[model samples]
Target: MTTSTESPCWFTSSYSDHGGQCVEVATNLPGIIPVRDSKTPGGPVLNFRAEAFAAFVAGIKAP
Candidate 1:
């Protein structure tokens, strides 16, 4: 599948606190989930498979 080279629209989770420690996620890209440290916007981004990201979030949310 062909993926676009478009820029990611990053956003921090609503659950994120005022502390400097946080992560950002951009969901605009299809088939990919880009994550980065909120403190370092210009830093490297970790690209994760959408399905895998979903599973990770599910796991985190699980009791």
Candidate 2:
């Protein structure tokens, strides 16, 4: 969970163009990566390990 003193710098991918269906991710935090829906900024966030998140992104980019 993110502490009150911390705020994630969320950003959406430039490839996102699915009629408002998109996700935002914040990798500024140490060890953890926070993710949330772009459509709902105030909604609940899902946390992932930094390494795991990196792997996921890499996989998506891989052909």
Candidate 3:
């Protein structure tokens, strides 16, 4: 399991543009991508494998 005590550096997409449904992702951690709702910074965070997150993003980018 990937573990990191380092704080996450959250980044929301520029396309979020005032959308209340935005999600933020942290790529600072090793081997995992941490995701949290932009509207709820103190809320629960979902952790996903970096590779899996990469694939998901790729799929979304695909036409």
Estimate the TM-score of every prediction: 0.87, 0.82, 0.86
Query: Which ranking of candidates, highest lDDT first?
Result: 3, 1, 2
Q: Model 1 shows how many backbone clashes? A: 0
Pairs with backbone N, CA or C atoms under 3 Å apart (clashes), candidate 1: none
Q: What value does the lDDT take at residue 21 in candidate 2? A: 92
Candidate achieving the largest TM-score: 1
2 or 3, greater by lDDT: 3
1-63 in candidate 1: lDDT tens per residue? 334559888788888885979999888889999999989999999999999999999999999
**With candidate 1 superimposed using the best TM-score fit, by how many Å does residue 20's alpha carbon deviate from the native?**
1.8
1-63, model 3: which lDDT tens digit per residue?
344658998888888886779999988889899999999999999999999999999999999
lDDT (10s digit) by residue, model 2, range 30-59:
889989988999999999998999899899
Each candidate: what lDDT? 0.88, 0.85, 0.89
Q: Residue 62's C-alpha lDDT in candidate 1?
A: 100
What's the distance in Å from true for residue 34, model 2? Answer: 0.4
**Clashing residue pairs, candidate 2?**
none
Clashes of each: 0, 0, 0
